[model samples]
Target: MSLLRIVFKSLRQHLLSTCITAFSIALAAGLLMSVWVVREQSRRSFTQMDSGFDAVVGIRSSQLQLVMNAIFHLENSPGNIEVEDYEKIKAEPGVALAVPIALGDNFKGYRIVGTIPEMFTHNEYAPGKKYKTAEGRLFDPELREAVVGSFVAQKLNLKVGDEFEPYHGLDFDEDHAHDETYVIVGVLEPSNTPADRLIWIPVEGLQFMSGHREESHEELSAVLVKFRSPLAGKTLQMKYNQPDGHLTMAWPIGAIVAQLFDKISWFDRILEMLAYLVAVVATGSILASIYNSMNERRREIAIMRALGARRSTIFSSVVLESASIAAIGVVVGFSIYLLITTTAAQFIRAQTGMVIDPMEFHNVMLFGPIGIVLAAALAGVIPAMKAYNTDVAQNLVPVS
Candidate 1:
């Protein structure tokens, strides 16, 4: 028989053992693939979110909270600061631009952000390096018209000419509804930042709707400040706070990314530990299954040896058979993992407002298949050794 035929025959004789080995390898590989897909997509989403602005200035509070609230629209704002304070910073010597933000409402858990048209330009978050409306026209400088984010429009099935009543606060209760209504004059294209999930309106309109005018409103949510030069950030930060000021400023990109990683670090570590544990257990199971099958195959190995097959040939054949089973298992496991990831993508996106593409592959996936094959080869070593050292002469002699 040819070498390939010999391998197939050996596997067919121990079909149960081969199946068990393949299943274990497949399971380990699937788990590894799922983890890699989730991690990589999350990183991509975060990187896109981080590219919008330089610094976020808000009420004196935790720098991380300001970033989470302003950049991601993930958490509630840290109270509010005076609009006049923001105006002062906007006119500062090194300040290139300052976009005031007024946030206090939500439509189905997504934030409504009130800011100037200049915000889209200053932050470079606009489409095609310039702000352009995907539907209808940009918000008129007046307070009654609003522009909806792409996700908000799609999710709510909203379009131009739709009228939406603003709520008094983030609460969705009917009682908190504001007296004035907003006309959706425009819809923004997907920018893949907080902009994609927010409802944007003129800052003056928010103040007018909220009934704050003349005197400085004590509650301005946050401000996006751009410096003339990168080095201007440190200087502006010091002057803005000034030890007694009611506002604090931080680099939004750095703060948001840092806090996100910090928050997920423990979870990532747990996942890593679980992955390693699964891999080790899978390896052990594959080893045990192949080793146990050796005794049942002893007569077969002896017969082959009696036919003038070299000891080395018998050892190589056994190891090669186990490796092939492991390889097949890895492929099957990866398919199962893809199915699970694709099914969960929509649910994850709805909960986190973060898009995940599960079909994307990363280099980390290679480890899973490689690990399975190595483990299978290592497991066959002991059984192969036993088969190689078999006493051919004694077996052929038979009892009397």
Candidate 2:
């Protein structure tokens, strides 16, 4: 029999342990790749996230909080800025565009934001990518008409011409539903941005929605600003961030978002360390499994030697078996990675409207599996050496 056939026979003899070891390898490799891919992809996507605007001017508050609230639709508005503040920011010398948004209600748990029609008519959420309606027309700024985001429309079974009462505040409440029934005039196309989860109405609708205090009139949540040049951001940031300034500006929006990842960077490092530790433990398991099986296979090794199998051949077979096991695990590990990453992608999309493609190839996918297989093969060296040094005469004795 060839050395490969002998290796296969030995593996078949200890199939259960071999399978268990391979499974451990699968878990380790899958976790390692998943952590790496998710971290890299998330960092890349979030750092590049944009709200079609370069900065947000809002009441003095945390820059991160303002960006999250205005751009990501996360966190509560820190406070409200006056309409005069919005006009002043819009008329700033270097300001290219400014759109104010008012937020206070929800329709079926989806936030209903109030903004002017100019946001859709004039602004590009990204370079040359203007918002387009999939269904009807943009909401009339003077009427109680709303434009629903694609994700919101899909999740809530909403369609153009459907009318619904706005619920007071961000959270949905049955008793606090406003008397005003806003018609959904349009459903926006999927922009793959945070806007896809919102229900947008005229700015006046949200500010004056029933049950809202009259004193809060003319107060804007934030003014989304786009500057003409980088220099403009510096000029504006210094102006708005002054100690005497009533409004704060979050300039270079990407930097504000990146700070979130920076703060949580230690957590990612911890996860990566745990993944590496799992990989080390998995490699050790391969070593232990093969080494512990050595005594039982000694007689077999002796018989192979008697059959004229070279010591080198026996050694090579042992090492190859370890490598083969790892190879199989690496194949299965990719399947596990697909499963994990797909679920993660779904959850992330549901929460943030950001799409993460699991099949998107990364360099780690190539190097990570190769590294695991090599480590596993190295793990078999001790057992392979023991097989090579087997005493032929002593182990070839007849067994009862």
Query: Backbone clashes in each candidate structure, one number apiece?
Result: 0, 0
lDDT of 2 by residue, 241-360 (tens): 999888899988998889999999999999899988988898888889889999999998999899888999989999988987888788898998898889998877777877788899
The runs of at least 3 residues in candidate 1 whose Cα sits more than 4 Å from the true structure, single-residue gaps closed, are: 1-5, 12-17, 126-131, 210-218, 241-243, 340-348, 351-354, 390-398
Candidate 1 lDDT at 195 equals 73
Per-model TM-score, in order, reads 0.87, 0.96
List the pairs of residues colliding in candidate 2.
none
Top candidate when judged by lDDT against the true structure: 2
How far residue 33's Cα lies from its native spot in candidate 2, in Å, is 1.2
lDDT of 2 at 154: 95
Tens digits of per-residue lDDT for model 1, 166-232: 7766656667777778899999877555576778888777766754444434447888877788778
